[model samples]
Target: MASNKPAPEAPSRFGSEYVDDFATRPATAFGTEYGADYATDYGTDRGSDFGNDFRADETGPERAWEEWNPTEESVRPVRGKHRVAKQRNGLARSSTVLGVGVIAAVGAGGMATAQSKPPVSISLPDSIADNLPDAKSLPGVGALFSGGSEAEAQEAVVASAPLTTAGITTAEAEQGSTDAGEALRARILQQAEQQQDAADAEVKAAAETAAAEKAAAEAKKQQDAAEAKIAAEKKKAAEEAAKKAEALRLAKLAASYAIPTSSYTITSTFGEAGSMWSSGYHTGLDFAAPTGTPIKAIHSGTVKSAGYSGSYGYRTVLELEDGTELWFCHQSSMDVSIGQRVTTGDTIGRVGATGNVTGPHLHLEVHTADGTGIDPMAWLRARGLTV
Candidate 1:
């Protein structure tokens, strides 16, 4: 069937198989189709032109070889860059080390500064500096900062000054301690001496008081003994004076009385025994004398009788004031009359032997008022007259 579309062309080895009657063809197509030498000519011509262009655009091989050889100027930039990079790395390392060292130094310096400046100020003597170690010889202080700035040098100088000054202060403190010890010992010695003195004074005072008391007691005892001696002497003298006064009173009474008769010899006592009398014993004392001797009155008395009685011739009786009778018996004569008064030493009668007499004597008798006879010798002696 004939359709109104164009017919499909066959696949050719050169290109699209469709051909136009008016289309232009390439020159290489003619040579390819005819298998001619035109391809060789064209290749040879282009090759020649390429050779000519290469000759015109580039230098010779000798010149290129010469350009490729390295020179000092050519290597300078690379080495410079490498050297700069190495220097940068070195600077970085140095900076890092410096930073760490600065931090450590600051920490240590802060502690040192704090210790050096105390709360209180202490000034030390200059002589201590002579004995100190030199700051330049110290390890991390002076030598480490020798090439550093002026501020670092000043810091080292400041750090070394204190150690020398502290040595002088220690010597002064030792001297002060020695002086204080001596003063304390002296004060203790003074107090002990004062206490000892006070004790000695107290002992002395007590001894004095005891001695005074002993002296007073001795004096009192001696005074009492003397007073007792005086009282005994006075009593003895008073007793001797009383005995002398009694003896003088008896002497006066004897002088007032008298004896009845004198110059007569006693022949018989009142109590004598005889057979010559009318009674059993002798009743009267006998005074033997010559006849007519005077008889005296013994004391002042009145005559009661003067007459001859039996056996008593010419008798006389005298009565005294106390009622005692004195009888002159056997008298030769009566001198005193009846009712007559006679005194002591007066004549009352004469001695006789007329009353149955043995011899010429007076027979005197003492009787009471009732006519009873008593001893005549005892009656006379009582009046202080010795008979």
Candidate 2:
């Protein structure tokens, strides 16, 4: 009585179209002709009737219902998974709002923390310590920090900290008069001047000390030089006095027998006609007189040399006490022989021009024991004679 084919399913208004969980009308999962399409199933499983499991594969001709165009009704909003896009947009907006609130909270917390804190203060260990004598009292630190009196120290501190007029106004407050500010300025200037005066005094003192030291050194040097000069002069005077005393004693001993020439004059002195004498000089006096002029000894002495020396013709030398020698040269003849003792008045030679001389004369000279010639005029003067 019934046909052997299955009955057609209920017709949908969108032919072969169905509503997904999102409420969007999609074409049948299976293609037309009631087989499976290639799409995967995403619903509850049932029997082969495919009521719960969607047909996921089909190899049939394209369906006319699959080509249906979108309509206002199909795009209408619905509930459940249909609102998924709106939920996602709402979640993004909420997350952004939450992030902004968290940032704002953190910023507020940071401001509050900063406002609650106190400003940092500066201090040094020396500022609080009372046991220490002062900054200058530390070991090896006295030279580093200049020392000063109490007043000078206060002045220095004020000078180092200058205050501007505007700063003063602020510090005094609006109720205070400008006179107070002027007074402060004057005080600061006074302090600075005091400090400068102290430093200037110190510098002056140091300079004075240096000058004093230099003066002391110069004074010491001068004293030393003066002492040395005095010592030298004293020694020289003592030596000269001793020499004079010795000379006087010797003169007294020789004076008893010494004699001056009775009739002869000093016609020539020693060292006369130096160019003609073999010894480079006529090293004796020449007394010009008659053929037999009397030649006398200046003191009691032994004849040391009596001979006819070259250019001297005839010569005689007398050796006195204290190692003195007297030379008689340019003589016509010698009256004394060698080693013969003669008084001051004894005739040792006669006046003549026997040596390389221009006229008849007698030459005389005096010498030390060592044979060094001495000024005969000086020797004669020492004996109280003007010759």
Tens digit per residue, CA lDDT, model 1, 55-133: 2113232211112457887666532322111133345533443343333323322211111121335666779877788
lDDT of 2 at 94: 32
Taking the tens digit of each residue's C-alpha lDDT, what string does model 2 give over 152-266?
A: 6666655542433334555454545346567577669979999999999999999999999999999999999999999999999999998989788766745654434545567
| TM-score, candidate number 2 | 0.35
Lowest lDDT block of 10, candidate 1: 109-118
Which residues of candidate 1, in runs, are more than 4 Å off? 1-250
* lDDT against the true structure, each candidate: 0.63, 0.60
Please identify model 2 stretches exceeding 4 Å from their true place.
1-197, 200-281, 304-315, 321-325, 329-338, 345-359, 365-386
Best-performing candidate as measured by lDDT: 1
In terms of lDDT, model 2 sits at: 0.60
